[model samples]
Target: MVSLREREAELANETQTLQTAADLFDASVSEAANLGQSSASVLVALQGRVDAAPLATAEASRLNLLQVAAAAQPVSIPTYQRASIDEKDLVDVGKAIDGVRLARESLPPLVTDVRDARSTVTAALTSFRGELSNLGSAIESEAAKAVTINDSASQSFRAAVTDAAARVKAAQQAGGDGLAEMPVYAASLDALRTENARILALEQAERDAAPTTPRNPGSGSNTGGGTNSGGGSNTGGGNQGGSPDTGTNPDPAPSQPAPDPDPEPVPDPTESEEPPIIIDPEPAPSGTVPGATS
Candidate 1:
Protein backbone atom coordinates (compact mmCIF):
# COMPACT_ATOMS: atom_id res chain seq x y z
CA MET A 1 0.00 0.00 0.00
CA VAL A 2 1.52 3.28 -1.07
CA SER A 3 1.25 6.31 1.25
CA LEU A 4 -0.64 9.40 -0.07
CA ARG A 5 2.49 11.53 -0.29
CA GLU A 6 4.46 8.76 -2.05
CA ARG A 7 1.72 8.20 -4.58
CA GLU A 8 1.59 11.94 -5.37
CA ALA A 9 5.34 11.99 -5.91
CA GLU A 10 5.20 8.99 -8.30
CA LEU A 11 2.41 10.67 -10.31
CA ALA A 12 4.47 13.87 -10.63
CA ASN A 13 7.48 11.93 -11.86
CA GLU A 14 5.37 10.04 -14.41
CA THR A 15 3.91 13.33 -15.67
CA GLN A 16 7.38 14.87 -16.07
CA THR A 17 8.60 11.87 -18.07
CA LEU A 18 5.56 12.09 -20.32
CA GLN A 19 6.18 15.78 -20.92
CA THR A 20 9.79 15.17 -21.90
CA ALA A 21 8.83 12.41 -24.34
CA ALA A 22 6.20 14.64 -25.89
CA ASP A 23 8.71 17.42 -26.41
CA LEU A 24 11.18 15.10 -28.14
CA PHE A 25 8.39 13.78 -30.35
CA ASP A 26 7.45 17.31 -31.31
CA ALA A 27 11.02 18.11 -32.32
CA SER A 28 11.32 14.94 -34.37
CA VAL A 29 8.09 15.70 -36.19
CA SER A 30 9.28 19.18 -37.05
CA GLU A 31 12.55 17.92 -38.48
CA ALA A 32 10.72 15.29 -40.51
CA ALA A 33 8.33 17.87 -41.87
CA ASN A 34 11.17 20.16 -42.96
CA LEU A 35 12.88 17.30 -44.72
CA GLY A 36 9.66 16.40 -46.48
CA GLN A 37 9.21 19.96 -47.64
CA SER A 38 12.73 20.24 -48.97
CA SER A 39 12.26 17.03 -50.88
CA ALA A 40 9.08 18.35 -52.47
CA SER A 41 10.82 21.53 -53.61
CA VAL A 42 13.58 19.52 -55.20
CA LEU A 43 10.96 17.52 -57.08
CA VAL A 44 9.27 20.63 -58.42
CA ALA A 45 12.59 22.01 -59.61
CA LEU A 46 13.34 18.72 -61.24
CA GLN A 47 10.04 18.77 -63.07
CA GLY A 48 10.71 22.30 -64.26
CA ARG A 49 14.07 21.19 -65.59
CA VAL A 50 12.53 18.27 -67.41
CA ASP A 51 9.96 20.53 -69.03
CA ALA A 52 12.66 23.03 -69.99
CA ALA A 53 14.82 20.40 -71.65
CA PRO A 54 12.96 20.59 -74.93
CA LEU A 55 13.25 24.34 -75.09
CA ALA A 56 16.96 24.09 -74.50
CA THR A 57 17.20 21.47 -77.21
CA ALA A 58 15.38 23.73 -79.62
CA GLU A 59 17.73 26.60 -78.83
CA ALA A 60 20.71 24.37 -79.48
CA SER A 61 19.23 23.32 -82.80
CA ARG A 62 18.67 26.93 -83.74
CA LEU A 63 22.30 27.70 -82.96
CA ASN A 64 23.33 24.79 -85.16
CA LEU A 65 21.28 26.19 -88.02
CA LEU A 66 22.89 29.57 -87.50
CA GLN A 67 26.29 27.95 -87.72
CA VAL A 68 25.39 26.20 -90.96
CA ALA A 69 24.05 29.40 -92.49
CA ALA A 70 27.15 31.25 -91.44
CA ALA A 71 29.30 28.61 -93.07
CA ALA A 72 27.33 28.41 -96.36
CA GLN A 73 26.95 32.13 -97.06
CA PRO A 74 29.58 34.88 -97.28
CA VAL A 75 29.00 37.46 -94.55
CA SER A 76 31.03 40.43 -95.88
CA ILE A 77 30.10 39.86 -99.55
CA PRO A 78 26.43 40.15 -100.46
CA THR A 79 24.60 38.54 -103.41
CA TYR A 80 24.85 42.00 -104.97
CA GLN A 81 28.02 44.10 -104.47
CA ARG A 82 27.67 47.39 -102.59
CA ALA A 83 29.89 50.50 -102.68
CA SER A 84 31.05 49.90 -99.11
CA ILE A 85 32.12 46.36 -99.87
CA ASP A 86 33.83 47.12 -103.17
CA GLU A 87 36.95 48.82 -101.73
CA LYS A 88 37.88 46.09 -99.23
CA ASP A 89 35.83 43.23 -100.54
CA LEU A 90 38.56 40.59 -100.01
CA VAL A 91 39.34 41.76 -96.47
CA ASP A 92 35.61 41.80 -95.69
CA VAL A 93 35.33 38.23 -96.93
CA GLY A 94 38.17 37.11 -94.64
CA LYS A 95 36.62 38.75 -91.55
CA ALA A 96 33.21 37.28 -92.33
CA ILE A 97 34.71 33.81 -92.71
CA ASP A 98 36.49 34.17 -89.37
CA GLY A 99 33.27 35.22 -87.61
CA VAL A 100 31.37 32.24 -88.98
CA ARG A 101 34.12 29.85 -87.96
CA LEU A 102 34.07 31.15 -84.37
CA ALA A 103 30.30 30.75 -84.15
CA ARG A 104 30.44 27.23 -85.50
CA GLU A 105 33.19 26.25 -83.09
CA SER A 106 31.14 27.48 -80.07
CA LEU A 107 28.07 25.37 -80.92
CA PRO A 108 29.50 22.04 -79.78
CA PRO A 109 30.07 23.26 -76.19
CA LEU A 110 26.59 24.77 -75.99
CA VAL A 111 25.01 21.50 -77.00
CA THR A 112 27.00 19.67 -74.36
CA ASP A 113 25.86 22.15 -71.71
CA VAL A 114 22.19 21.56 -72.47
CA ARG A 115 22.60 17.82 -72.16
CA ASP A 116 24.27 18.25 -68.78
CA ALA A 117 21.34 20.32 -67.52
CA ARG A 118 18.95 17.52 -68.40
CA SER A 119 21.06 15.04 -66.47
CA THR A 120 21.19 17.25 -63.35
CA VAL A 121 17.40 17.61 -63.25
CA THR A 122 16.91 13.89 -63.49
CA ALA A 123 19.37 13.20 -60.68
CA ALA A 124 17.84 15.79 -58.39
CA LEU A 125 14.38 14.30 -58.86
CA THR A 126 15.53 10.84 -57.90
CA SER A 127 17.27 12.14 -54.76
CA PHE A 128 14.22 14.11 -53.66
CA ARG A 129 11.94 11.10 -53.98
CA GLY A 130 14.22 9.04 -51.79
CA GLU A 131 14.38 11.70 -49.10
CA LEU A 132 10.58 12.10 -49.05
CA SER A 133 10.11 8.40 -48.52
CA ASN A 134 12.57 8.37 -45.64
CA LEU A 135 10.97 11.35 -43.93
CA GLY A 136 7.50 9.79 -44.16
CA SER A 137 8.72 6.66 -42.45
CA ALA A 138 10.41 8.63 -39.67
CA ILE A 139 7.26 10.70 -38.99
CA GLU A 140 5.14 7.56 -38.73
CA SER A 141 7.53 5.97 -36.25
CA GLU A 142 7.65 9.05 -34.02
CA ALA A 143 3.82 9.24 -33.99
CA ALA A 144 3.65 5.66 -32.84
CA LYS A 145 6.04 6.35 -29.98
CA ALA A 146 3.94 9.33 -28.87
CA VAL A 147 0.82 7.17 -28.82
CA THR A 148 2.45 4.52 -26.64
CA ILE A 149 3.75 7.11 -24.18
CA ASN A 150 0.29 8.67 -23.92
CA ASP A 151 -1.32 5.31 -23.13
CA SER A 152 1.21 4.41 -20.50
CA ALA A 153 0.92 7.80 -18.83
CA SER A 154 -2.88 7.49 -18.65
CA GLN A 155 -2.69 4.06 -16.99
CA SER A 156 -0.17 5.23 -14.42
CA PHE A 157 -2.25 8.28 -13.54
CA ARG A 158 -5.40 6.24 -12.98
CA ALA A 159 -3.62 3.71 -10.75
CA ALA A 160 -2.10 6.54 -8.69
CA VAL A 161 -5.55 8.08 -8.12
CA THR A 162 -7.09 4.81 -6.97
CA ASP A 163 -4.26 4.08 -4.57
CA ALA A 164 -4.45 7.59 -3.04
CA ALA A 165 -8.23 7.24 -2.59
CA ALA A 166 -7.83 3.92 -0.80
CA ARG A 167 -5.22 5.36 1.55
CA VAL A 168 -7.44 8.35 2.48
CA LYS A 169 -10.42 6.06 3.19
CA ALA A 170 -8.33 3.91 5.54
CA ALA A 171 -7.01 6.96 7.36
CA GLN A 172 -10.59 8.24 7.86
CA GLN A 173 -11.81 4.87 9.20
CA ALA A 174 -9.07 4.77 11.85
CA GLY A 175 -9.75 8.37 13.03
CA GLY A 176 -12.71 10.11 14.84
CA ASP A 177 -14.43 12.00 11.93
CA GLY A 178 -14.04 11.18 8.14
CA LEU A 179 -15.40 14.60 7.22
CA ALA A 180 -12.77 16.40 9.29
CA GLU A 181 -9.99 14.69 7.20
CA MET A 182 -11.77 15.00 3.83
CA PRO A 183 -9.88 18.26 3.08
CA VAL A 184 -6.60 16.31 2.93
CA TYR A 185 -7.88 13.93 0.25
CA ALA A 186 -9.49 16.81 -1.65
CA ALA A 187 -6.18 18.69 -1.77
CA SER A 188 -4.43 15.62 -3.23
CA LEU A 189 -7.20 15.26 -5.82
CA ASP A 190 -6.78 18.90 -6.83
CA ALA A 191 -3.04 18.49 -7.27
CA LEU A 192 -3.54 15.42 -9.44
CA ARG A 193 -6.07 17.29 -11.61
CA THR A 194 -3.60 20.19 -12.10
CA GLU A 195 -0.85 17.84 -13.17
CA ASN A 196 -3.13 16.07 -15.64
CA ALA A 197 -4.19 19.43 -17.16
CA ARG A 198 -0.53 20.39 -17.71
CA ILE A 199 0.09 17.08 -19.48
CA LEU A 200 -2.93 17.64 -21.71
CA ALA A 201 -1.76 21.11 -22.63
CA LEU A 202 1.68 19.86 -23.64
CA GLU A 203 0.16 17.08 -25.78
CA GLN A 204 -2.12 19.56 -27.52
CA ALA A 205 0.84 21.77 -28.38
CA GLU A 206 2.66 18.80 -29.90
CA ARG A 207 -0.27 17.82 -32.08
CA ASP A 208 -0.75 21.38 -33.29
CA ALA A 209 2.86 21.54 -34.46
CA ALA A 210 2.93 18.17 -36.20
CA PRO A 211 3.60 18.00 -39.93
CA THR A 212 0.81 17.32 -42.42
CA THR A 213 0.86 15.84 -45.92
CA PRO A 214 1.11 17.80 -49.17
CA ARG A 215 4.16 19.69 -48.00
CA ASN A 216 5.73 22.45 -50.07
CA PRO A 217 9.45 22.41 -50.66
CA GLY A 218 11.28 25.68 -51.36
CA SER A 219 13.84 26.54 -54.08
CA GLY A 220 17.12 24.99 -55.15
CA SER A 221 20.42 25.47 -53.32
CA ASN A 222 22.59 26.20 -56.33
CA THR A 223 23.74 29.84 -56.57
CA GLY A 224 25.25 29.73 -60.07
CA GLY A 225 24.08 31.64 -63.13
CA GLY A 226 21.48 30.41 -65.62
CA THR A 227 22.67 27.53 -67.81
CA ASN A 228 21.49 26.35 -71.20
CA SER A 229 20.14 22.85 -71.85
CA GLY A 230 23.64 21.52 -72.22
CA GLY A 231 24.60 23.00 -68.78
CA GLY A 232 26.83 25.62 -70.46
CA SER A 233 26.78 29.30 -69.46
CA ASN A 234 24.76 31.69 -71.65
CA THR A 235 27.44 34.37 -72.04
CA GLY A 236 29.83 34.38 -75.03
CA GLY A 237 32.97 36.20 -76.34
CA GLY A 238 33.74 39.95 -76.20
CA ASN A 239 33.09 42.34 -79.12
CA GLN A 240 36.09 43.20 -81.34
CA GLY A 241 36.29 46.73 -82.89
CA GLY A 242 35.96 47.60 -86.62
CA SER A 243 38.87 47.54 -89.15
CA PRO A 244 41.65 50.14 -88.42
CA ASP A 245 42.59 50.86 -92.12
CA THR A 246 39.01 51.75 -93.06
CA GLY A 247 38.66 53.96 -89.98
CA THR A 248 41.86 56.10 -90.53
CA ASN A 249 42.26 57.30 -94.18
CA PRO A 250 42.24 61.21 -94.48
CA ASP A 251 42.20 61.91 -98.32
CA PRO A 252 39.04 61.64 -100.45
CA ALA A 253 37.23 61.52 -97.14
CA PRO A 254 33.58 60.60 -97.77
CA SER A 255 32.47 63.93 -96.21
CA GLN A 256 34.72 66.22 -98.40
CA PRO A 257 34.68 66.85 -102.32
CA ALA A 258 37.71 66.19 -104.60
CA PRO A 259 39.91 69.27 -105.67
CA ASP A 260 39.67 70.53 -109.39
CA PRO A 261 42.79 70.94 -111.66
CA ASP A 262 43.97 74.52 -112.70
CA PRO A 263 42.43 75.94 -116.04
CA GLU A 264 44.65 76.63 -119.26
CA PRO A 265 45.39 80.38 -120.15
CA VAL A 266 43.77 81.89 -123.40
CA PRO A 267 46.11 82.58 -126.46
CA ASP A 268 46.81 86.25 -127.69
CA PRO A 269 45.11 87.01 -131.13
CA THR A 270 47.22 90.25 -132.14
CA GLU A 271 50.40 88.20 -132.81
CA SER A 272 49.03 86.88 -136.17
CA GLU A 273 48.17 90.37 -137.66
CA GLU A 274 51.60 92.10 -137.04
CA PRO A 275 54.01 89.48 -138.37
CA PRO A 276 53.85 90.47 -142.28
CA ILE A 277 55.62 94.10 -142.25
CA ILE A 278 59.12 94.50 -144.05
CA ILE A 279 61.83 97.37 -144.42
CA ASP A 280 63.00 99.10 -147.79
CA PRO A 281 66.70 98.66 -148.87
CA GLU A 282 69.32 101.35 -149.73
CA PRO A 283 70.40 101.76 -153.51
CA ALA A 284 73.23 99.63 -154.67
CA PRO A 285 76.46 101.65 -155.22
CA SER A 286 77.71 98.71 -157.05
CA GLY A 287 76.47 95.20 -157.43
CA THR A 288 79.20 94.06 -155.12
CA VAL A 289 78.87 96.97 -152.69
CA PRO A 290 75.15 96.46 -152.04
CA GLY A 291 75.64 93.39 -149.94
CA ALA A 292 78.88 94.65 -148.30
CA THR A 293 79.29 96.73 -145.16
CA SER A 294 80.89 100.19 -145.60
Candidate 2:
Protein backbone atom coordinates (compact mmCIF):
# COMPACT_ATOMS: atom_id res chain seq x y z
CA MET A 1 0.00 0.00 0.00
CA VAL A 2 2.82 2.37 0.86
CA SER A 3 4.67 1.68 -2.38
CA LEU A 4 1.44 2.08 -4.35
CA ARG A 5 0.86 5.41 -2.72
CA GLU A 6 4.43 6.47 -3.52
CA ARG A 7 4.10 5.48 -7.13
CA GLU A 8 0.87 7.38 -7.42
CA ALA A 9 2.52 10.36 -5.80
CA GLU A 10 5.28 10.47 -8.36
CA LEU A 11 2.92 10.16 -11.30
CA ALA A 12 0.74 12.79 -9.80
CA ASN A 13 3.68 15.18 -9.91
CA GLU A 14 4.57 14.31 -13.48
CA THR A 15 1.00 14.94 -14.43
CA GLN A 16 1.45 18.69 -14.13
CA THR A 17 4.15 18.82 -16.77
CA LEU A 18 2.18 16.45 -18.94
CA GLN A 19 -0.72 18.84 -18.93
CA THR A 20 1.51 21.69 -19.91
CA ALA A 21 3.19 19.71 -22.69
CA ALA A 22 -0.15 18.55 -24.02
CA ASP A 23 -1.45 22.08 -24.34
CA LEU A 24 1.65 23.18 -26.15
CA PHE A 25 1.63 20.06 -28.25
CA ASP A 26 -1.98 20.55 -29.28
CA ALA A 27 -1.29 24.15 -30.22
CA SER A 28 1.67 23.06 -32.31
CA VAL A 29 -0.50 20.49 -34.00
CA SER A 30 -3.03 23.15 -34.95
CA GLU A 31 -0.38 25.41 -36.40
CA ALA A 32 1.21 22.54 -38.24
CA ALA A 33 -2.15 21.57 -39.64
CA ASN A 34 -2.57 25.02 -41.05
CA LEU A 35 0.91 25.00 -42.48
CA GLY A 36 0.46 21.61 -44.09
CA GLN A 37 -2.70 22.79 -45.80
CA SER A 38 -0.97 25.88 -47.09
CA SER A 39 1.94 23.85 -48.42
CA ALA A 40 -0.36 21.44 -50.20
CA SER A 41 -2.34 24.28 -51.70
CA VAL A 42 0.79 25.93 -53.05
CA LEU A 43 2.22 22.74 -54.49
CA VAL A 44 -1.01 21.82 -56.22
CA ALA A 45 -1.29 25.26 -57.79
CA LEU A 46 2.33 25.14 -58.82
CA GLN A 47 1.81 21.80 -60.50
CA GLY A 48 -1.17 23.07 -62.44
CA ARG A 49 0.60 26.21 -63.52
CA VAL A 50 3.72 24.30 -64.51
CA ASP A 51 1.72 21.79 -66.51
CA ALA A 52 -0.54 24.37 -68.10
CA ALA A 53 2.24 26.75 -69.09
CA PRO A 54 2.98 24.71 -72.18
CA LEU A 55 -0.39 25.41 -73.74
CA ALA A 56 0.28 29.10 -73.52
CA THR A 57 3.81 28.66 -74.77
CA ALA A 58 2.67 26.55 -77.68
CA GLU A 59 0.03 29.10 -78.60
CA ALA A 60 2.59 31.87 -78.37
CA SER A 61 5.05 29.99 -80.58
CA ARG A 62 2.42 29.23 -83.21
CA LEU A 63 1.37 32.87 -83.16
CA ASN A 64 5.01 33.90 -83.67
CA LEU A 65 5.21 35.76 -80.33
CA LEU A 66 8.78 35.01 -79.33
CA GLN A 67 8.78 36.95 -76.04
CA VAL A 68 5.50 35.48 -74.83
CA ALA A 69 6.62 31.92 -75.57
CA ALA A 70 9.90 32.59 -73.78
CA ALA A 71 8.06 33.91 -70.76
CA ALA A 72 5.66 30.99 -70.67
CA GLN A 73 8.40 28.39 -70.43
CA PRO A 74 7.33 25.55 -68.17
CA VAL A 75 8.50 25.56 -64.57
CA SER A 76 9.67 22.07 -63.72
CA ILE A 77 7.40 20.19 -61.36
CA PRO A 78 9.11 18.67 -58.35
CA THR A 79 8.49 15.48 -56.46
CA TYR A 80 6.55 16.86 -53.53
CA GLN A 81 8.60 17.28 -50.38
CA ARG A 82 7.34 17.72 -46.83
CA ALA A 83 9.10 18.69 -43.63
CA SER A 84 10.23 15.37 -42.17
CA ILE A 85 8.97 15.71 -38.64
CA ASP A 86 9.74 12.47 -36.83
CA GLU A 87 6.81 10.17 -36.31
CA LYS A 88 8.32 8.69 -33.18
CA ASP A 89 7.79 11.84 -31.16
CA LEU A 90 4.11 11.73 -31.91
CA VAL A 91 3.88 8.09 -30.94
CA ASP A 92 5.78 8.76 -27.76
CA VAL A 93 3.33 11.39 -26.67
CA GLY A 94 0.40 9.10 -27.21
CA LYS A 95 2.04 6.24 -25.40
CA ALA A 96 3.17 8.38 -22.48
CA ILE A 97 -0.32 9.67 -22.07
CA ASP A 98 -1.70 6.17 -22.16
CA GLY A 99 0.97 4.51 -20.04
CA VAL A 100 0.66 7.05 -17.29
CA ARG A 101 -3.03 6.35 -17.12
CA LEU A 102 -2.43 2.64 -16.99
CA ALA A 103 0.24 3.03 -14.33
CA ARG A 104 -2.22 4.81 -12.13
CA GLU A 105 -5.06 2.32 -12.61
CA SER A 106 -3.21 -0.97 -13.14
CA LEU A 107 -0.39 -1.77 -10.76
CA PRO A 108 3.04 -1.40 -12.32
CA PRO A 109 5.64 -3.49 -10.49
CA LEU A 110 5.74 -2.49 -6.81
CA VAL A 111 9.26 -1.09 -6.62
CA THR A 112 9.02 0.66 -9.96
CA ASP A 113 10.56 4.09 -9.59
CA VAL A 114 7.74 6.12 -11.07
CA ARG A 115 10.36 8.72 -11.91
CA ASP A 116 11.16 6.66 -14.97
CA ALA A 117 7.51 6.99 -15.90
CA ARG A 118 8.15 10.32 -17.47
CA SER A 119 11.58 9.73 -18.97
CA THR A 120 10.60 8.79 -22.48
CA VAL A 121 7.91 11.40 -22.45
CA THR A 122 10.21 14.03 -21.03
CA ALA A 123 12.80 13.34 -23.66
CA ALA A 124 10.19 13.26 -26.39
CA LEU A 125 8.65 16.48 -25.18
CA THR A 126 12.04 18.13 -25.11
CA SER A 127 12.84 16.92 -28.57
CA PHE A 128 9.43 17.91 -29.85
CA ARG A 129 9.66 21.40 -28.40
CA GLY A 130 12.96 21.91 -30.13
CA GLU A 131 11.59 20.55 -33.40
CA LEU A 132 8.40 22.59 -33.08
CA SER A 133 10.41 25.76 -32.65
CA ASN A 134 12.10 25.04 -35.95
CA LEU A 135 8.99 23.74 -37.67
CA GLY A 136 8.21 26.86 -39.65
CA SER A 137 11.76 27.20 -40.77
CA ALA A 138 11.89 23.53 -41.66
CA ILE A 139 8.73 23.83 -43.69
CA GLU A 140 9.99 26.93 -45.45
CA SER A 141 13.30 25.29 -46.20
CA GLU A 142 11.63 22.23 -47.69
CA ALA A 143 9.30 24.37 -49.76
CA ALA A 144 12.19 26.47 -50.94
CA LYS A 145 14.42 23.52 -51.74
CA ALA A 146 11.77 21.55 -53.59
CA VAL A 147 10.83 24.49 -55.74
CA THR A 148 14.39 25.58 -56.56
CA ILE A 149 14.44 24.34 -60.11
CA ASN A 150 13.70 27.11 -62.64
CA ASP A 151 14.41 29.68 -59.92
CA SER A 152 11.57 28.80 -57.53
CA ALA A 153 8.53 27.27 -59.12
CA SER A 154 6.04 29.51 -57.31
CA GLN A 155 7.55 32.65 -58.83
CA SER A 156 8.06 30.79 -62.06
CA PHE A 157 4.52 29.48 -61.90
CA ARG A 158 3.10 32.96 -61.49
CA ALA A 159 5.17 34.34 -64.35
CA ALA A 160 4.19 31.47 -66.57
CA VAL A 161 0.53 31.95 -65.80
CA THR A 162 0.75 35.66 -66.45
CA ASP A 163 2.68 35.25 -69.68
CA ALA A 164 0.32 32.57 -70.87
CA ALA A 165 -2.61 34.90 -70.36
CA ALA A 166 -0.73 37.66 -72.11
CA ARG A 167 -0.24 35.49 -75.14
CA VAL A 168 -3.96 34.76 -75.24
CA LYS A 169 -4.85 38.44 -75.04
CA ALA A 170 -2.20 39.27 -77.60
CA ALA A 171 -3.79 36.82 -79.96
CA GLN A 172 -7.14 38.53 -79.46
CA GLN A 173 -5.59 41.94 -80.10
CA ALA A 174 -3.90 40.79 -83.33
CA GLY A 175 -7.22 39.68 -84.94
CA GLY A 176 -5.60 36.31 -85.75
CA ASP A 177 -7.33 33.49 -83.95
CA GLY A 178 -4.35 32.40 -81.81
CA LEU A 179 -3.48 28.82 -82.53
CA ALA A 180 -7.10 28.21 -83.57
CA GLU A 181 -6.91 26.19 -80.35
CA MET A 182 -8.43 28.45 -77.72
CA PRO A 183 -11.14 25.95 -76.82
CA VAL A 184 -8.68 23.12 -76.56
CA TYR A 185 -6.31 25.22 -74.49
CA ALA A 186 -9.02 26.39 -72.09
CA ALA A 187 -10.34 22.85 -71.76
CA SER A 188 -6.92 21.49 -71.01
CA LEU A 189 -6.21 24.13 -68.40
CA ASP A 190 -9.53 23.42 -66.73
CA ALA A 191 -8.85 19.72 -66.75
CA LEU A 192 -5.45 20.23 -65.17
CA ARG A 193 -6.91 22.32 -62.37
CA THR A 194 -9.59 19.73 -61.73
CA GLU A 195 -6.99 17.02 -61.60
CA ASN A 196 -4.84 19.02 -59.24
CA ALA A 197 -7.76 19.40 -56.89
CA ARG A 198 -8.41 15.71 -57.09
CA ILE A 199 -4.88 14.35 -56.73
CA LEU A 200 -3.01 16.48 -54.22
CA ALA A 201 -4.69 16.17 -50.84
CA LEU A 202 -5.67 12.81 -49.36
CA GLU A 203 -8.70 12.25 -47.22
CA GLN A 204 -7.60 12.32 -43.57
CA ALA A 205 -9.58 10.61 -40.83
CA GLU A 206 -7.17 11.00 -37.94
CA ARG A 207 -8.02 9.51 -34.60
CA ASP A 208 -6.25 9.91 -31.33
CA ALA A 209 -6.52 6.22 -30.64
CA ALA A 210 -6.14 4.86 -27.12
CA PRO A 211 -2.46 4.74 -26.27
CA THR A 212 -1.28 1.44 -27.65
CA THR A 213 2.18 1.30 -26.06
CA PRO A 214 2.58 -0.68 -22.85
CA ARG A 215 4.17 0.97 -19.84
CA ASN A 216 7.58 -0.53 -19.22
CA PRO A 217 9.86 -0.51 -16.20
CA GLY A 218 11.98 2.61 -16.69
CA SER A 219 10.71 4.62 -19.62
CA GLY A 220 7.61 5.65 -21.54
CA SER A 221 6.60 7.14 -24.93
CA ASN A 222 4.05 9.96 -24.81
CA THR A 223 3.25 10.97 -28.30
CA GLY A 224 1.21 9.22 -30.91
CA GLY A 225 2.64 11.75 -33.32
CA GLY A 226 -0.32 13.93 -32.34
CA THR A 227 -1.97 13.80 -35.72
CA ASN A 228 1.07 14.89 -37.67
CA SER A 229 1.93 13.76 -41.20
CA GLY A 230 3.35 10.47 -40.03
CA GLY A 231 0.67 9.53 -37.50
CA GLY A 232 -0.71 7.17 -40.05
CA SER A 233 -1.18 6.58 -43.70
CA ASN A 234 -3.75 8.88 -45.27
CA THR A 235 -4.63 6.55 -48.11
CA GLY A 236 -5.21 8.08 -51.53
CA GLY A 237 -8.74 6.79 -51.65
CA GLY A 238 -10.11 8.44 -48.57
CA ASN A 239 -10.35 7.51 -44.95
CA GLN A 240 -7.87 7.05 -42.16
CA GLY A 241 -7.43 7.52 -38.83
CA GLY A 242 -5.31 13.73 -26.02
CA SER A 243 -4.35 13.68 -22.49
CA PRO A 244 -4.15 15.27 -19.20
CA ASP A 245 -1.68 15.91 -16.44
CA THR A 246 -2.41 16.74 -12.92
CA GLY A 247 -0.57 16.11 -9.76
CA THR A 248 -2.48 14.98 -6.69
CA ASN A 249 -5.01 12.19 -6.54
CA PRO A 250 -4.91 12.04 -10.35
CA ASP A 251 -7.67 13.49 -12.42
CA PRO A 252 -10.54 11.17 -13.20
CA ALA A 253 -9.60 8.51 -15.71
CA PRO A 254 -9.01 10.24 -19.02
CA SER A 255 -11.48 9.60 -21.78
CA GLN A 256 -9.86 8.06 -24.83
CA PRO A 257 -9.03 10.80 -27.32
CA ALA A 258 -11.52 11.68 -29.99
CA PRO A 259 -10.77 11.51 -33.69
CA ASP A 260 -9.08 14.54 -35.10
CA PRO A 261 -11.33 16.34 -37.49
CA ASP A 262 -10.26 16.01 -41.08
CA PRO A 263 -8.05 18.83 -42.33
CA GLU A 264 -9.66 21.61 -44.32
CA PRO A 265 -8.12 23.24 -47.37
CA VAL A 266 -5.71 25.91 -46.16
CA PRO A 267 -5.03 29.25 -47.87
CA ASP A 268 -2.49 31.34 -49.83
CA PRO A 269 -2.03 29.93 -53.28
CA THR A 270 0.07 31.78 -55.80
CA GLU A 271 -2.34 33.86 -57.82
CA SER A 272 -1.89 34.55 -61.52
CA GLU A 273 -3.27 36.90 -64.12
CA GLU A 274 -5.78 34.18 -64.81
CA PRO A 275 -5.42 31.99 -61.79
CA PRO A 276 -6.82 28.51 -61.75
CA ILE A 277 -9.88 28.25 -59.58
CA ILE A 278 -8.33 26.63 -56.53
CA ILE A 279 -11.24 25.38 -54.55
CA ASP A 280 -11.06 24.55 -50.85
CA PRO A 281 -10.88 20.84 -51.36
CA GLU A 282 -13.98 19.25 -49.94
CA PRO A 283 -13.49 16.57 -47.30
CA ALA A 284 -13.27 13.10 -48.70
CA PRO A 285 -16.61 11.38 -48.61
CA SER A 286 -15.11 8.55 -46.52
CA GLY A 287 -11.88 6.67 -45.81
CA THR A 288 -9.64 5.22 -43.13
CA VAL A 289 -6.19 6.00 -41.83
CA PRO A 290 -4.08 2.93 -41.23
CA GLY A 291 -2.74 2.39 -37.66
CA ALA A 292 -5.84 3.60 -35.92
CA THR A 293 -6.42 0.97 -33.24
CA SER A 294 -10.20 1.34 -33.31
Top candidate on lDDT is: 1
Residue-level lDDT of model 1, residues 14-113, one tens digit each, is 4444444444433433433343343333333322222344324433333333333233311121121122333246675555445444444544454444
Question: Which ranges in model 2 have alpha carbons more than 4 Å from their true place?
Answer: 1-9, 48-294
Model 2 C-alpha lDDT per residue in residues 1-294, reported as the tens digit of each score: 233335446666545444444454444444433433333332333333333344333322322322222222121211211233443576644544455456544333321323242333334333432332233233333333333433322344434334444454455456433323233333434443444444333222123443344344223233333342344644442123322223222223457999999999776566455757767855644565554555
Candidate achieving the largest TM-score: 1
lDDT values of the candidates? 0.40, 0.38
Evaluate residue 77 in candidate 1 and report its C-alpha lDDT on the 0 to 100 scale: 12
